[model samples]
Target chain A: MHTLIVIDRPPYGSWSGRESLDMAFSLAAFDQPVSLLFVGEGVLWLSQRQDASAIAQKSVERNLKAAAIFGIEALMADQSACQRFGLGDGTLIDGVETVTDLRVTMRRYDHVVFPG
Target chain B: MHTLHIVSKSPGHPRFLECLSMVDTNDVVLLTGNGVVALADSSIEVPSPLYALEGDIQARALTPDSARCQVIGFDDMVALTIQSQRVISW
Candidate 1:
């Protein structure tokens, strides 16, 4: 089954988004069909040039770069949320797809999940 | 309804706005826990066919506008979930 992991929380503020990423990576490790959908503040994860140095944390952008190598299907962001966060074409990380309709995108996956 | 969006976060929470943004006209929204705070928040424009958990509303000491939001009990909430084709808990 195709699993879509939804992340609606912003990065750095909490560990939930990271945990969700870990879950996606684990699923990909198992050769499971999995994709990530970033919505709301969660779209911030796709923003390029994230410097987490001041927060004493590793940058998520670096970790996200390994997703393709690990076989993760895709990284998607809500188009409207990206606009709200000012993440236009030039500002987003490479390979992330911007989807306009959240419902339709979600329905494409057999299973949908959100991180705690 | 196609989807029933259950929001348990407060109005200030990012998921609250995300849920509202994703809500379609045919979708129903049930506000639970801190989500009930949206009823009293004038700044947030909640979608129509909104329902707030009675217990949550009472706990928050919020009085929802009867014309806009219908207050529902646990049983009604259960019925709503069963009625909708899909349920999204945010």
Candidate 2:
């Protein structure tokens, strides 16, 4: 089934971001059609500047990269949300498609999994 | 059917309020992180079965004693991604 997963939290600081991504990756790893959207602070996971693994915790960056490798191509970041966080233009985060319209994209999915 | 709803944000964002407005006591609402801090407000109106940790709620620190539904740490506001489901965020 085609599943739409949304992640809008940062890494390590809290648990929502990592947990949600874990679910998304698990689904996609099993060959489920998965798409991930990042909004608010969630965009932090994609930032190339992020160093989540420095502390030995599960790395959001590594998970995102894994999701892409595992065929979870629906990774996206909210444009306005990026602006709100002062990450204007949201530093180029690998494996994420930054878009301006969240609601529209949200409506396109069959199953919306807020894995946060 | 038992449903556990976990939220990890304070009243910091409008989405948190939206997540709260979506459900009630029958479901479990886990508040952690900024969410644990958010609980201090008292007005959050979390529907019961509220399982929260003093820290990372998403990490699934506190487990609710129940069958049918399992407890998992949901990242901040990422719980809203499921279909036909309701969620609370920060």
Q: Which candidate has the top score in lDDT?
A: 1
RMSD of 2: 8.8
Worst 10 residues of 1 chain A by lDDT: A107-116
Please give the distance, in angstroms, between residue A27's alpha carbon in candidate 1 and its true position after superposition. Answer: 6.7
Over the stretch A18-78, how does candidate 1's per-residue lDDT look in tens digits? Answer: 8898999999999999898988888888889999999899899999999999999999999
lDDT of 2 at B82: 45
Q: Which stretches of candidate 1 lie over 4 Å from their true place?
A: A1-3, A22-34, A47-54, A65-72, A79-95, A107-116, B12-18, B41-46, B65-67, B73-79
Write one digit per residue (lDDT tens) for candidate 1, span B37-88.
9899888888999999999899878988998799999999999988977677
- Please give, as one word, the docking class of candidate 1: incorrect
TM-score of chain B of each: 0.96, 0.51
The per-model lDDT (C-alpha) reads 0.87, 0.60
What does DockQ come to for candidate 2? 0.08
